[model samples]
Target: MGIIKKIFNKSRSPEDGIFFEEMRKILGFNPVDLSHYRKGFTHRSSNKTDENGNPINYERLEFLGDAMLGSVIAAHLFKEVPTGDEGYLTKMRSKIVSREHLNELGRDLNLIKWVESKVSAQHFGENIHGNLFEAFVGAIYLDRGFTYCEKFINKKVIVPYVDIPKLEGKVISYKSLVIEWCQKEKKQFHYDVFEDNGNEDVKHFGVRLKIDGKIVAKARATSKKKAEEKASQRAYFAFQEKINKK
Candidate 1:
């Protein structure tokens, strides 16, 4: 009876001890308390309430993760690129933490598998991975604190990829660059975005790039920004030789 009672007692812990252990393996750190990590992966769709009857989800965790990511990335860039000015360092950090890169990282790690949600995962957009990644960072901050968070960022983000020269060439937004050039050259520019009746599961926007009252390029994409950027990029390339000649 004593042994049986002990086994029952072990089974009644508020913490999912086994799950926590597995999570430690996954995160490469023994979480001091499981609640932080648990809340990190908790999707809003579950509509869960905490002990205080307040909503519980990964949103707050995401905020923390974003800040952690930026801090660590900034530190790394500052030390590595001593010659880089403020704008250069900021742009490099932005490239590393950009939504596209974060999404790719989260997807690579299959981070969403642990998310507790009432909604189907398939229904979620690509941005979910990036959000989950940020939430995970927040959880790490709450669980093990900043030192561990810095280590994780260094191991996962900086050491493997961060090529300063290559990052400098990476285009975060071609549309912004083209627009700036147009403005500088005193050329009128407009991105005429309109809905496209296309044969596809998702709705798409079509963008026409006009410069000095002439159509330079046209592109279509699932989002207005994407379409405009595509058109702008194309226009930039098409007129690159001529534009640089001036």
Candidate 2:
């Protein structure tokens, strides 16, 4: 029998052992303290708590993970591009640890399967993936330490991704780009956002991007931020030729 199957055969309580095996596959090392990892997957909706009644969820871990990602990515950029200025290095690190990138990482790892949430998985927003990834990183830090956390980041984030050349051209925020372009070219721009009702269960917001007295783009998303960003992204492409010139 396979080792994972044998794990079940050998252990009376197999869930922990199964999780260890699964974690080993992703982390490339056996997890020591399983509770940290379990907390990483626990959603706030689950309403779990510790012995002292401190809420048990991934939010704290996610915060730590964000800092860890920033620290590691910043260090990698410093070493990789010795000639890069602070602005250049900061921008590069932002690109690497952007919400979109982290979300993609979580999706690639299929981290949602491990999530313990009262809410339906399908209804969870895109950020959940990124949050889980960050929480996982936090769990690694707590379970092992900075050395293992750095190693994990280097193995998963740095080695496979983090191409300085490719990242240089990557846009971390289309909204920022759009605003900068408009200001530089002396073009009047505005984002008119409003509640957009849909038949779907989730509430959505709509944003209209107007530039130089003309409605340039419109987008609807679950949040105002997303809706605005989507409109900005569309506007960026619409004015791509003009925006790239400056």
Candidate 3:
């Protein structure tokens, strides 16, 4: 048996779960309530519920985590960039808390292995990483409260991942930038997005960018935001010369 096989072949025992061990190692502390972490990793497809029959999954935790992450990032940015105005600080916070970066962080930590889900990993979309990361953050907040949450962010996120200069140049939403530029340039633009139900297992959306009533670009992605961004990118390239001239 090879290393990969050996790793996967480990018995998933109830008493000594390898995943829980890994979680403890990653978290640097033993979890007070394993159920919190369990729910943190759970996907809504599992159809789980608490004693009161309320849905018990990471979605609610993800919501909580998102707010916490934002608060932490905002606090850090505020102190780090004391001279930064609201727009600058807001942009920095956005860059730090962006879904793409959060997804990268979560994936690097391999948070998916703990998830309890009926769906296959192959079936899940990329956003799962970021969402799961946020869910885990929420779990930490609930389990350990604000102090530990702040410590974790500082140690795991701020110390390693955040750099002021790099964050300043980071683009959280290229689509937003393109739209802003279009509006400022007095150019007429429209995005026509429609659901595309094709042979793929997941539903997708197709987007076309119309500039001055002419089709400038088109794109398709798993979600509307993705499709819009892709269309915006294509539109940006198509109108690059014209937009840059102004």
Query: What is the C-alpha local distance difference test score of each model?
Result: 0.82, 0.85, 0.80
Q: Using Cα atoms with residue i matched to residue i, what is each candidate's TM-score against the true structure?
A: 0.62, 0.64, 0.62
Better of 1 and 3 by lDDT: 1
Error of 3 at 44 (Å): 1.0
Error of 3 at 215 (Å): 54
Model 2 ranges off by over 4 Å: 1-12, 170-246
Give the top-scoring candidate (TM-score): 2
In model 2, which range of ten residues has the least summed lDDT?
3-12
Give the candidate number with the greatest lDDT: 2
1-246: candidate 1 lDDT, tens digit per residue: 653454345553544876666676667666666778789889999999978999999998899999999999999989998999999888889989999989966775567878899999998899999999999889899877899999888877775446564588766667888988988989999889999956533567999999988999999866787688779878877887776889
What CA root-mean-square deviation does each model show from the true structure? 12.2, 10.3, 11.3
Position 36, candidate 1: lDDT: 85
Candidate 2 backbone overlaps, count:
0
* Candidate 1, residue 191: lDDT: 85
